[model samples]
Target: MTEEDIATASGLPVYTWRRRHGADFRARVPVINPRERLRLYDAAQATAYIKGAPIPASPADDAAHPDDLLSDKEAGVVLGIDATTVRAYATTGYLPPGTERHGRTWWTRRSITVRRDSPDQRHHSPGRQPGDLRDRAPRHRRDPRVTEVSALLLLGQVTTDEIAEHYQVGRRTAQRLLAAALTVSED
Candidate 1:
């Protein structure tokens, strides 16, 4: 049925029908092509029906854009570093301060952009390689947590709650620590 017929039968105004189905109706109506119908309908919708409509921007245009907002993972991807390294750098003051709340970290795209543009930012050295022993070495030789968890795991007798209570960490963290220790011992 025609939009006019719909509006008439439904007791709504013809302009309402035109606003809603003017394009499609124009397409099926005699003498009107799809493009002309679409244009007319878009005009009607823009001028009479819609409360607020956005103007279309140019597809080919390039503008001075702001840096994208980034999460830790996204910032790490942009900086070509691992998430752990990014966190370490942020924690150690190598990078500028980022927003921190409830144990989550967030960085602005501008932060990374500015850091990349800065002249004083140090690039990794080419000649000196980090040691393989760094990965395989014992915990006391590396992380301070090593001494604490190693003693508990080596005893092989502590409950998860006991470990959590002793370390003042959450039960989940305690479980993860235990699992990691077991993996290291097996390796």
Candidate 2:
């Protein structure tokens, strides 16, 4: 398994795991991909090791982002907060640092998820009280960006890749948004 895979299984950052138990863990497992520093561990052994490890302060809630990457909005969705809150968290170090590429902030979903699932989140959660109408209601309105992307797609003037680059979503999300918009228009 790769370092990332081990991280996913253990619910800890690879670096944190290494810092805590690197020597022992490495001695127990054989390195298969030296370039990636990946170690080979079968499923059963990996599961047992993961179960035995101490839970990190930041632990992944679920295996949500396999690629370990996400746009701010995507991270927000996973974090049960808004994009603005996500940015704030990133700025305050509540969330992991992100890279700004092409005017968009890209974060590690693993880190965001860890923060989300971590107990520390309760202290820093946004001020949304119980019985908030916005939280209870369904947001029937489509995202404006999705609508705009769909229009550009229907015009056939912009490629899907361009839409993905512009919108900071995956090609599949772009396609689905376009398809949904087209369906709505047809209706």
Candidate 3:
């Protein structure tokens, strides 16, 4: 049963079970289904834990190898990928699901190795392809008006009023274009 199940079965208030006994209960009970999000515990073991009695020792034969467990970061180091990517793969079923215990997620060594050695694990950088960068210019786009204004002002051939008349624009627009031209030319 779950924590709520154990609490309700033992006649403890929900909040009391959570705020008071939650950590203690978790510490005492080993979840039976580690691969699943919903944690499940043996009914007898849950009862034993709830009664404040010593829980029986489970079978040692069914236990995982002590050195087989690895955290996601450790798995990432093994796979040469970022920990977040490792976690993403796990969640996306590219890797085996991890077990959460004591607020840490762990994956088995075998599962990580299987993913690491898989045929499709090798990746290539998606390099430049035909028509890949048709419009990707190296520099920011500059206004043609600004360039023309800059050249005319540099040649001392036109005033802002002349620019306004030539470009058929407002006085404020001429002033702005002239200012933009000055800044662009200075740069």
Candidate 4:
């Protein structure tokens, strides 16, 4: 259906549909095919776009704009935030950093929009996946030495002086370590 047909079916006046929020919605609609002077759109999909409804995937969408890419500023608009904020978030691991192409960063619409899916319900933290223990990192942090020292300090079986002697540290340093361990155990 044509834009006018959509306006009429949606109970919006043609002029209103051609302006205001409806016009903004049109900007998001993939341009109608044939690259012609006049274009056509799938009526239901166009209406869905205007109504803020989820659009089902379609072949036409895949065919259009094969090289579609948004610059940092355009991505910011899609994300409803300022450009500088988008740039910072993308660079600092907060948002997906778009590909650096032709000496500039460009983002696909999917990269920015996919982040909106059930974000707060996520289970694990981002970055490296769970797996093997590299030599650089311990298999686990359960060092018996630390556990024994912490236990001795907690049970009053050891004092700052004794801890200093065993660990070969100054009395002041042992006292500080004991105090820190106490505070952590409280938490």
Q: Which residues of candidate 1, in runs, are more than 4 Å off?
A: 1-67, 101-103, 119-187
The CA lDDT at 181 in model 2 is 69
Q: What is the C-alpha lDDT of each candidate?
A: 0.58, 0.67, 0.78, 0.66
Runs in model 3 with CA error above 4 Å? 4-62, 65-113, 116-131, 138-156, 164-187
Comparing 2 and 4 by lDDT, which wins? 2
Off by over 4 Å in 4: 1-67, 118-187
- Sorted on lDDT, best first, the list reads 3, 2, 4, 1
Q: Write the per-residue lDDT of candidate 4 for residues 1-187, one digit (tens) a residue.
A: 5667677877889788788655675566665544434455665577787677975454464463524566676667767878898788777666778887545677777777665443742335464556734425656444344555777767776678887898888988778767766655676
Error of 2 at 126 (Å): 18
lDDT of 2 at 171: 91
Q: How well does each candidate superpose onto the true structure, as a TM-score?
A: 0.30, 0.31, 0.34, 0.30
Residue-level error in angstroms, candidate 4, position 170: 28
RMSD (Cα, Å) of candidate 1? Answer: 17.6
Residue range 7-97, candidate 3, lDDT tens digits: 7987988788888888887787787767656676777688888777889875354454544567777789889999999998877677877
Report the error of model 4 at residue 22, Å. Answer: 35
Cα misplacement distance, residue 126 of candidate 3 (Å): 8.5
* TM-score for predicted model 3 compared with the true structure: 0.34
Ten-residue stretch with the least lDDT total in model 4: 116-125
